[model samples]
Target chain A: MSLLEVKDLKVRVDEREILHGLSLSVNPGEVHAIMGPNGSGKSTLSHVIAGKPGYEVTGGQILFRGEDLLEMDPNERAAKGVFLAFQYPVEIPGVTTWNFLHAALNAQRKARGEDEISSPAFLKKVREVAKSLNIPQDMLKRGVNVGFSGGEKKRNEILQMALFEPAVCILDEMDSGLDIDALRIAADGVNALRSPDRAMVVITHYQRLLNYIVPDVVHVMSKGRVVKSGGKELALELEESGYAQFEDAA
Target chain B: MNVVVAKTGTGRALGDAFAVARDRLPGKGAISDLRRQAFEAYERMGLPHRRIEDWKYTDLRALMREVLPLAPQPDATALDRAAGTAKAQAIEGVRRLVLVDGVFAPDLSDLAGLQKGLTIRPLRDVLEAGDALSGQAFTADSSNPMIALNAALATDGVVIEVANGTVLTQPLQIVHIASAAAPGAIVTRSLLRLGRDAVATLVESYLAADGATAYQAHDALVVAIGDDARLDHVRLVEDATGAFNISSATVSLGAHAHFNTFGMTTGAHVSRYQLTVAFAGEGSKVETNGVNLINGKQHADTTLLLDHAVPHCDSREIFRAVVDDRAHSVFQGRIIVRPHAQKTDAKMMTRALLLSDEAEADNKPELEIFADDVTCGHGATTGALDENLLFYMRARGLPEKEAQALLIQAFVGEAIETIASDTLREVAIAAARRWLEARA
Candidate 1:
């Protein structure tokens, strides 16, 4: 059985339909890359699956381990192991990164009836993860994402991803604002978390990031639905030929 | 056509109450004349209504349903109750000066190991001596009637004088505790004087003893910062929901003086803080920050008149309010730069967060700059919590209420973080967190 399944998902935002009959399946230990042009509803799909408000799933069945995912709240979905690396992480002024991370981790643990992580232990885990991501310890002391460079913001998202250790990861435009070195570092962090029991959905517009974190399958998305699914080489083809033919073909 | 101005019932009650208790009031001689003059000022002004620009948002005439008679001085039982409060609210490493029912209680205060160059006296003594400084704050610097009312009815308060060139590491805390059980009003006037080149930290708190319900408070603080002196003042006020308080603060800064202050209020049914600050000498800087966490039909208003009367003076004011559950918050910030006050720098910003649809926030920020070379700017923003931020937090597994508390904390933390003292900042943050927890 697939670890995650989306069957004929249709989503509307503000009375306007964005995703129509989008379907996909992901097994354990797999990485699926969804390539699309701007306004292809990639982010909408990620947000809808994460249970963010304002996205009305008009017609869809999202199953996580055969459980109905749409019925849960965003926090419940998060506690059940779903994480989204935001394209643009919102800056929460006056809230230090360490405090936000600790709260988030403990809240999830509490929701699952597990004991909270002690402050010292949480600090140790954060330091280990932050060190691996080259995130400065001072950044943890500063307000979350406040005054952070674009690269720093993306890396901070990766740090959260590492800390949360979600079973399914959705990387949305992770390479948009990162420099090559920063992108490599972020991709390395993602690679380290790609365990046999974990799955990932990489949503990006360009084929640039697929080079660093190779995808097992690449799906071409146009309008709101996936147009083609093939092996990883499909990304190189699209990169060489550009998305114009796909837009016209659809 | 003939027009007559009628006084409100509350106004009439206050006047009749004053007439009945005038002989029982503190001070005599010249102080007696000052009290009569101040009360006359209050009588002439009547009750502040919406027509008055200063009271536009607060409509004191309508909100003040009735005026309670002055509370009696604390008896033995009252002192025993107040000692526990003073002990509970005590900050470690700080000396406390206690006032029970607006009367100074030395037994509850920490005056055993008095530091050198620091002198503390009850304001009754200064009022009895007819000290010129005691009457300064009640004058025309503020047209608000409450200042005059405080002057006329005040029973007692603390007066702290720091000698010139004296530096004290330990902070001095003045705890104004309303201890009378029956519903009544409390009046106090505290004064802090910093001599030339002196440095100190002052913390004043307004508290109510257990069972003290439906009381009214009229308190004032007059501050004088001398040349090259530095003062960091923190004012924290928390009372029962049935309480009503009107507090005023007037500050004058001398040449190159530095005055940094932070105020937080999370209590009372109707509370107003009228602050008047003036830079009397050049090259002085003042930083004023405040937060108001109001809920459940509470109303909090902060009116600031910051005068940049001298050249090369810099002032910054940041105020925030979080209104929930039909509560209302008001902020009136006015910065004035005189014609010759060139090179003056001033900035004021106020933000309000409305947590419920029924809540209201009024932000009126004005700048009157006559000096051409001065740089001045003011901004006011009233908004609800950012839905995107909430979604972001919830997506990361923080529950709804926790996410909201965190955001509100962050919002108020911007203003709280300006406190220079670690201890005071922690106190402000902890109070804010408790306010959040109660909100949930």
Candidate 2:
């Protein structure tokens, strides 16, 4: 069975169906990139697959490792190794980064029937991971993304993804607000988490991030569903030619 | 016994309702004179009815029908039993001085080996000498009728004196336990004096047992901060749901003194806490922060008046209220900058989060500035929780209930985080948690 599967997913937001019967499947160790213009349901797909409420799935199933991901809560799906790096990471004031990450990690661990990592061990591992991502140590003590710059917030998203190392990680516009330096750092952090047992779905508007991430499959989305799927060259072709052809075809 | 209901010249009831209780008060001399002066002030000012602008939210006459005697002596069994409660145990590490029914409970208190620069004594114990206090006499002025009542009827209260150049690590906890089985009002007057360059934290708690109706408590706290001194005061009010609590705290800050007051209000059917801060010296700073969670049909009023009397003084007041059910919460904060009070920086903000359609919060933030060189502003906002934030959290897979709780916790956490001490922060958070858990 495919490690990550979305079968005929239909997500409606505010009575407007944003994701209409979209289906995709990815094997373990495969990196898939979904690129499209604005309002192309690129972000909706990632959010729906992550079990976000309000986006009703009128007809679909999201399977993670053969388990129905949509049936679980967001945190439960997270415990089931499904993670979505939000396009606009929510700023949780008064909740320290260290505290939030610890809670999230331990929640997943508990779901797997594993003992929580000790504070010292968690700190040590978090420090190492944060250092590798070039995230300053003081940021760990501050409120979660409360006053973070756009670039810093993007790096923080990748930092969290690296820390959790979920089986099916979806990065929705993780490269949207980042500079070249921050983009490289974020991509590198994501690349470091790429393992044989894990899969990733990168959602973005531009194909520039595909240069470093090097996805195995590239899908072009327009009007709530994937219109075309191809190899990594598809991203380059779409970047050079734009979504003009897809828009006209639809 | 008829509960004299004579209408006075000002459309208020003026009678000898408290005369018998006043005559029954023990002790004599200057302390008695203080009580008489307070009684006279009460006779003139009387119990604040709806006419008084400050007491508009909590009409005293409507709740307290007649004069109630001040409760004398602590119920050893009751205090002993409450000692085992969860909230009592939370203050184990604090230097506690317990007062039951307005009378000090020495047996239940731990005053041994008190901080080097600190002294805790009862009001009667130090009432022998007029010069015992370095500051002005504890007289009840017309500015506060409740203070007048408390001064007239106060049996006992905690007196704190912090010596110069000393910083106390632990907070001095004053627990005022009200078991108003008696038919009289309970009045408590506390005076806090912080010397030059001294630092201290004072935590006060007002708790009442069940079945104590027609209860009237007039509590007053007068804090005089010396030059360069720092004081942090936290007051937690958890009275009986039927009790009527009207309390006032007047804080006077000297040059370079820093004063911070954080209050948590939850109980009492009609309760009001008035805070008046005067920057009497240059470069003084005053910060007042409070949060009130009123549920059921409870009415809570938190009013503050900050007077920047001197130049180069800064004052900040932040008050928030969360009203649920049919409860009502009122926050009236006024910051006044006097003429020639140059370089005065003052800010006041009150935000209310209404949890139900029937619940209401009245926020009145006013700034009166007469000085050109001062910066003062006041703002108030009352609304329900953000629907967008709730939806966002729910979209993240959190149940709607969990999402609402998270958003609310975050909203109130802003006020809780302003607490300087970690222990106090935890205590406040725990109080908020208890409030949420009861409803959830």
TM-score of 1: 0.95
By summed lDDT, the worst window of 10 consecutive residues in model 2 chain B runs over: B9-18
lDDT of each: 0.90, 0.79
**TM-score for all models, in order of appearance:** 0.95, 0.86
Clashes of 2: 4
- In candidate 1, the residue pairs with backbone N, CA or C atoms under 3 Å apart (3 or more residues apart, or in different chains) clash, namely none
Question: For residue B381, what is the lDDT in candidate 2?
Answer: 90
Off by over 4 Å in 1: A240-250, B1-5, B129-142
Output the lDDT of residue B212, model 2: 56
**i-RMSD per candidate, Å:** 0.7, 3.6
User: Model 1 chain A — which ten-residue stretch has the worst lDDT?
Assistant: A241-250
- Pick by DockQ: which candidate is best? 1
Kindly list the per-residue Cα lDDT of model 1 for residues B267-297, writing each as its tens digit: 8889999889999999999999999999999
Model 2 lDDT per residue over B198-271, tens place: 99988988777555555777788888899999998888887877787888888889999999889998877788
Question: How good is the docking of model 2, as DockQ?
Answer: 0.20
Q: What lDDT does candidate 2 reach at residue B65?
A: 49
